[model samples]
Target chain A: MIEVAGVTKRYGERAAVDGIGFSVSQGEILGFLGPNGAGKTTTMRILTGYVPPTSGTARVAGFDVQEHPIEAKRRIGYLPEHPPLYTDMLVRPFLRFVATIRGVPGKDINARVDRAIERCGLAPVAGRLIGNLSKGFQQRVGLAQAILHEPDVLILDEPTVGLDPSQIRDIRQLIKSFAGAHTVILSTHILAEVTMTCNRVLIINEGRIAADETLEQLAARGGKTRRIALRLARPGDGVEGAIRAIPGVLSVIREGGQDGAFVVETEGTRDAREAIAQAAVTHGWGLLEMRPITLSLEDIFICIIQGEEAA
Target chain B: MRNVLAIAWREVRTYFTSPLAYVVVGVFLMLSGWMFWASLVRFSSLCLQYGNNPYVFNQLNVNDMVVRPMFGSMAVIFLLLIPVVTMRLLAEERRTGTAELLFTCPITSGQVILGKYLGAAFLLAVMLGVTLSYPLLIMATSAKPDVGPTLVGYLGVLLLGLSFIAVGLLISAMTENQIVAAVGAFGALLMLWAIGWVADSATDTVAYRLNQVTFGLWDKLHLGLGGPTVGDLLNKLSVSEHLGDFRKGLLDTEHVVFYLSVVFFSLFMTQRIVESRRWRG
Candidate 1:
């Protein structure tokens, strides 16, 4: 429901978003991962029609953002990094106002506003002034406004930034509930937010997209070159050499600072556990434990970022 | 149009919900009330002096002596109050980051400008409405309040306030700081109001040309031109200058068009400035 093609936003001599392209299909929740100053917010601003991209085009629900701003914007529900709320307004009135301006039918305005308030868990604070609400509740108010009109696409920037763990979990649950009915592009620097809520991940770094893959695909890629940690009860001579001798075993080295422990780097998806076990028996090295180290998303992110820096 | 009204209604509600509306309105009414009382006292003193003198009494028109001076004083008060009313229209939105919500909405820049301008204008209307009690008091106590001129004078006040709020709203859109917006609007309005002072020092032809285009309401009192001339052109250009004619109960369409045109032009420029932010961002 959202398409960004070769978008580059330049401010004078600096490019905030350089040659970035991505798309989110209907009902797909795509997590936008990037560190600070990674052009994630800039890309969201362009998608929402708040800023015009210097080059290239952004479309929401098949409408060009710059060329047909109103039409495109009508289909988008945007929650900026700051939430863009009027602090002086009460929660209910504010949502009603948002609904009105977003072209919600007058007859259904109350229903829509009430639904949003309930969905964002803002019913208790509905009568309170927004400025007086806690940051987490205020963030809910922001999300409530974005979803008030039930737009086809949602572009949220750091929606869960300042929340406590429970609030973060609540917001993540709320975002995850939008799957398959609303196409959402959630931008955040938090690694777990993506893992918990996103179907696919697009990692942007230094004004460019560093990596884009499904969660499973990225995990599979990380598993392509595997590492294993092993421990032995007996100290046996030539154990490392014997383990290294196994086919598909790339290297076997003793782990420093840990006695009777070794790390094995293997090529491909081969299960070297059997070979290592056999080697331990043949060398009379008492086997203690052996497990393949699974790479987390954080590791994958760091690896991609570090790989980019190295390149 | 519905979107414009929605935005306008929300802004109006905000004005009242915050301390800004009450504070500005309260201060404005106090100043207007004081000015009214002062003008009434000065008129009563004049009445006493001319009570027995037929010639002077005939010259001492109550509308001329009391109502006209009150309107003039009220205009000066508006010069101060209007900037305060409009300072937060766009500037506060930008400051608090709500402008992003507005821009990302389906509404156009023109609609936002219209909504903000109308919202501030409505506040000015309420302020002017409260001052009506002063004129009603005169109507009740005096034998004749010269209802025609008094009504037109009220109309003149509203137009002048409308024009001033438009300029103030435009100034508000230029910056995000409320104090800066308020002070900047005051400076712009002062420049517009004080421009007529310079017209007096120039030679007759130059003075007429300068006052015609400069911002001063006093020039219309001196208007004797029967046809379009340099002086006529300059008189048309001054916002306050047209109020002088309305004070005499003239109700000229020319003055009405001038006020409306100034309002339209200012709002147009404000919309342009707002639309440019998206491009410049």
Candidate 2:
């Protein structure tokens, strides 16, 4: 469990994280989505007791990060953007070092580190130097270190920045599997990853939380259906008007372009293909392709960020 | 204490397992060997002219020759070596981002500092131990070596070495650059070593004021919390004063207290700096 109350971090004159507050309940994987310099890392640092917030307070696992730092920190695991790895040390030794510092007994250290190694899929590279490993393996080792202590809260900042597509998917599934045991707050710029792994998404932009809601809620609010491009062999025709009259068609805006196409913006579950088709037959107009446009997560991200800026 | 020891244990192990430790040991043996041989050759040739008799003013050259200056140069070596050893201690952690791991742990900052200090100090002691044989070689050949004073002198060097490592640890925590850490540590130890001369120099203009704050080992030869000599004064002021007594064959309690106090002070300062790091991180 974590509670952040009006947390803000400022460096000299620049505000890294402005007044923002959020909480993560037990067993919930909260996604912290933000563009670069959105103060996501700063917020994560405050939560993990790695850095003090310039103002406000953060509590993790019911302990105040400032007043009870060690206790708060003990409950959480943090994987920084860079992974905080010792390039020289081998994987197993480094994990043992982490476990030792976490107050794990020597006898239990080996077992815990082994379990972490297995959980993070670091078995083959357990004895190799972390610096020599591939980027994906290094990321896994970083993940191994974070969970070595079996912390209740895991804060991973940009966990999959450089991994390949398959590695990213594996990490995503691994993170998804970790949901029930550890309350994870992972900040990433990758929109699809968040959509795939996160139960809830908090879109951060320009040092403020732009939107905080579940995937469905966000999709409903910002996920307008595809704007259908209908081209007809007519100029200044009310075929667009009749098409607008169709059910589930929110609104239609026509544009001057090649072949005189009309941009139809829809707002419901209903696809207007049947209605538009019948209209074309009655109007005796030559119907070109009537493909329904699709908005990807990238489009939604840009829309949300740009929409926030405009507001 | 156990938590601190656990960290210290790991830190000590890292020293031996890492190349930094080997480099430090090799550098010390190579350099101190040169200095020791130079001192020995000077002692042996001078002994030929003096007829192996301890009667050159009966004021033996062990204090004036080998042990005394070795103690002084050890501080210089600490200046050179401590930064190299400790430069990456905390700074590399910060740069590589592993400091977060240390900070987020259940252990206290004091424990971390104490552990790191002991680990590093033990390493220096081991290095000192290797060179101990060289001094023993002198004792082995001497007709009637003043074993008491020679032991005292080595003890003095150990205490002085402790002070340098402690000072070096604090300086290392202040920056990310090992070079800067070395420079800062060197400058600080140099100032401590030269403080006696500076105070003596200032004795002309600020005699009244300098007498109160002047922590010179050479001046206050006797009087301390742990003993009657200036070594005892170390618990209150200048560290070298405490060490100087041990160099002269007096195991004053005050000198021991002085050295321990420095060790604790440096550890305390390091803890505060490491803890305060969270605010900036």
Candidate 3:
């Protein structure tokens, strides 16, 4: 439902979003992961028709954002980083106003607002001034405003940023629930958020797309080589060579500053733990600890970003 | 149109929900009411002083002495108060980041500018509407206040108020700071109001110099380029100059056109500034 091609947003000589291209299919939840100043917000703005890209085009629901902004924007619901809320308005009335501008029919405004309020769990504070709500509740109100018109696409920037743990969980659950019904593209610096809520992740670094892959594909990428961290009780010579001689064991390196501690790399398709244990016993090297290290999403994210920077 | 009204409705609702609408309207009414009472007292005293002199009494007509001056004071009051009403119209949107919501929505910049202009204009209308009690009170108590001039004077006030709002809206669009917008609009409106003084003072010197320069061309071409002097053009540009006709109960199309052109030009510029945001972003 969204396509961005060769989009570069430059301010003077500095490009905030360098020529980045990505497409999202209908009913897909694509998570945009990037650290600060990674052009996440700039990309979302371009897709939402808030700011025109300096170089290329972004199309939403088959309409070029610059050429047919009204039509493209009609199908988009954007919740900016600050939420775009009027603090003076009551929650319900504010939602109604948003619904009106989002082109919700007059007769259906109240109904749609109620549904959004209910969905976002804003019923208790519906009649209260938005300024008086807590940050989490205000964020919910912002979410309600974005989803009020039930647009086909939802572009949220840092949706869960300042919320407490529980509020974060609730927001992530709400976003996860949007999958398969609404096409969502949310940007965040939180790695777990993508793991919990999105099926695919796009990692951006320094105005470039460093990595874009499905979560399973990312797991498999990290799975190509398995590392086992082994600590031996007794000091031993040739421990690394002995471990490397085992079948299916790729290589073994002794860890620094620790006696008899070594990391063994092996083929992902095979298990070399039993063979290593047998070798340790025969050589009188007591196997104190042997654990396989699985790469978490955080590790993969940092690896991708740092790898991009290094290159 | 629905989008425009939605935005307009939001603006109007925002005004009332905050203290802005009530405070501005209240202060405007109190000041205008005091001006009306002061002028009425002065008019009654003048009547008593001229009670026996038909010549001065006839010259002291109610429309001339009371309603006309009241419209003049109201115009001045609007010059001060309308900026306050318009300062937050667009500036607050930018400050609070609501401009993202507005620009990203399925609406044009023209719609946003028009909606905001109409919203403030609605408040301006209400300010003018409540003051109608002044003229109505005079008609009830006084014997012969000309209704034509009074109504025409109101039309003038409305147009003047609209032009002020348009100018204020344009200034508001140029900045994110409400105070800056308010002060800038006040300065611009004051300049427009006082521009006629500069014209009056410089007319002879400037027009004579222009006539000297253009004398040979006019003599050669037999053209009437000498008709409107430099001062005449400057006076025509002054906002207060056009308001004089409305205060005198003269609904000259020329003055109406002038006030309308100001409104149109300011609103058009506001729209352009708003649309430029996408490029500048």
Best by DockQ: 3
Q: Per model, how much of the real contact set is kept?
A: 0.87, 0.73, 0.92
Better of 1 and 3 by lDDT: 3
Tens digits of per-residue lDDT for model 1, A106-173: 99999999899889988899999999999999999999999988999999999999889999999999
Residue A246 lDDT in candidate 1 = 91
- Give the CA lDDT, 0 to 100, for residue A196 in model 2: 88
lDDT accuracy of residue A196 in candidate 1: 89
Consecutive 10-residue window with the lowest summed lDDT within model 1 chain A: A302-311
Task: Report the lDDT tens digits of candidate 3 across residue range B1-281.
Answer: 99888888888998888899999999999999999889889999999999999999888888887888898999999999999999999999999999998888888899989999989988988888999898788777854689898999999999999999999999999999999999999999999998778675564544455547886664566543345566777898899899898899988999999999999999999988888866788
Q: Candidate 2 chain B, which ten residues in sequence have the lowest lDDT sum? A: B225-234
lDDT of 3: 0.89
Which tens-of-lDDT digit does each residue in B94-130 have in candidate 2? 6677767677678777777777778887888898889
lDDT of 2 by residue, A1-311 (tens): 89999999987788888998888899998889878888888888888777788899998889999999778888888888988787877888888888888767778898999999998899999999888999999999989888888889999999999999999988998899899999999999988888889899888887788888888777665344656888887635676678888888877777775567888877656777888888887787778768876666566677788864210
lDDT of 3 by residue, A1-311 (tens): 99999999998899999999999999999999999999999999999988889988999999999999889989998999998989999998889888988888899998999999899999899999999999999999999989988989999999999999999999988888888889999999998888888999999999999988999987766778788999998847778778888999988888874577888999989998899889989998888999999888888888888873210
Which lDDT tens digits does candidate 1 get at residues B29-145? 898888878878888888888899999877877787778888898899988888888888999888888999988999888988898888888898899899888888888876367
Runs of candidate 2 with Cα error greater than 4 angstroms are A223-226, A233-251, A266-274, A291-295, A308-311, B52-73, B142-144, B204-242, B253-258
| Winner by DockQ between candidate 2 and candidate 1 | 1
Error of 2 at B35 (Å): 2.9
